[model samples]
Target: MNTLQHGFQLNYGNTDVMLLFEGQPDHLVPCTSQILLDSDLFLVAGRMVGHSFLHGGPALAGISEAVVDVLFGASPDMTTITVEDCPDLERRQTIQLLDGNKDLSEEEKDAVWKLADMWDLPGVTSDNRKWLFSRLLQHAVLGRTDKQIKQFRRGLKETCIWQLLTERKDVIPLMFPRERDVEIKPQMVLDQILWPLETTNEDEDYPVETRCRIAGYLREFIATASQSSLRGLVQFWTGWEVPSSDMQLEIVQGSLPKASTCFKSLRLPGHYTNFKDFSQDLNACVATCDTGFGLV
Candidate 1:
């Protein structure tokens, strides 16, 4: 396993130099490992509201859910980290680090901290998570879904950016056109809508097959997160008036447009009728888009 070199010096401010060891690095400084520091900083800020740090690059993507696992100290891999276990085997160590000076029980520690506070962290913990998740959701919507975390982390920022759309009424502009009753066909959803945004994707070409795979999974995530069917999720994405039932059939028959691709493999319902019912149910679902709301 790749490990931080012992006695390595990471200078912070003018007065601080963090000392890393083979076993565990000091919590005060940064490290080369993305998951370790990212997980630590998130818990510290969410629970204590004072500690913060700057993180960059792809490794620290999905810091919020990762840290929640560490703080609650549970190893169950769900939506956040897909691996059955963390590669570093530091989940236990991570828990110890976050327990800190508080005397409260571990479960109490988790119950007290909220995701909104996590978003408020004044350093890279908040910034990187925001950027990472924005990228991930963007890839999913635009048709570039990922199956493995190592790959999906690449689009974390783009994914979270799209999630921010539901944050308020104003987000309607960036995601949906100003006109009402505008129903975007799957192909049109790919070409006309998602690709235009340069900020959402990396500056490189993407294959259509890859885009389709991503979109399929992303659609499932929307249904799962929204707790509705495929149809309801589409309504949420477009903000347009509901299309006729026959129109829904036409859209379903067509290929997945490039506008809605992702890198992850999303679990979706089997048939068209089921998807329609799912959408109707999703439309009626209570709004649950709070930051980190669907992470589980």
Candidate 2:
């Protein structure tokens, strides 16, 4: 008989072996030496389950679920293995291993989710859950048929993930299109349409019809937006000096055609001159208006 490092005796066949319980310092358990020699059993040194047999002492901490099932025969009550039982192991490795397998199944994904939930793993946590949700949403959106997109959208609405769509700032355009009959706030729609127009390169390769549609959308939105929002938008895009409420209204009314004409002209080549003219017209309007305020 040879004693293993953790005070478990290794013996073959019918030989007697002694096992020490680190939790019970003074007690020893007797076992057939065949248990040590079982092909399915693997002994790992660390803490066992939730408790250490001996503080800072080598203990049998890691055991495969298969090994436990085989050792216990027909009944295995252990449902979970925690970090304390396998201090050297990381749950991410198991998830990654599962993810890498080309033949992954739904059951395997569920198992991964279960393990992540048990371990409180990062990939499945609240903060990172959006990554998974967005990928699924993207897959659905890019599906070949309108029926597929509509089906996926309907399915999503029935799940908790639908609530997350509203909370995601980066994916609003993907989830809600102006052409779609979905119910979305007007302000959100306006912001989405305006962002690319304001931020993108003027020479960028966006389709002219798209630009005209955005312009038309903006024109309609301005007609309905509160006077304060109109005033704010004018100051934001034109860098005009602040105007009194009456003058602000007048500026908004006068600028509507300039905005519309600029967007419509985008459909033609060399339309850059139209934008230049629009800017000059705006400056002339502002200067003429400023004279009435005695501030020119």
Stretches of candidate 2 exceeding 4 Å from the true structure? 1-96, 99-103, 122-296
Per-residue lDDT over 19-125 for candidate 1, one digit per residue giving the tens place of the 0 to 100 score:
22122211111223444344442233222211110111111112223322332224323434322212233332332323234454555444323322343422213
lDDT of 1 at 148: 25
Question: For candidate 2, which ten residues in a row score worst on lDDT?
Answer: 21-30
What TM-score does each of the candidates earn?
Answer: 0.16, 0.15
Top TM-score hit: 1
- Scanning candidate 1 in windows of ten residues, the lowest lDDT window is 49-58
lDDT of each: 0.29, 0.32
**Against the correct fold, how does model 1 do in TM-score?**
0.16
lDDT of 2 at 221: 47
What is the C-alpha lDDT profile of model 2 across 105-213, one tens digit per residue?
5665575576655544433443455444333222211211223223323444444444454565444333222222222344433442323343344565444454454
Which runs of model 1 end up more than 4 angstroms from their true locations?
A: 1-188, 192-266, 271-276, 284-286, 291-296
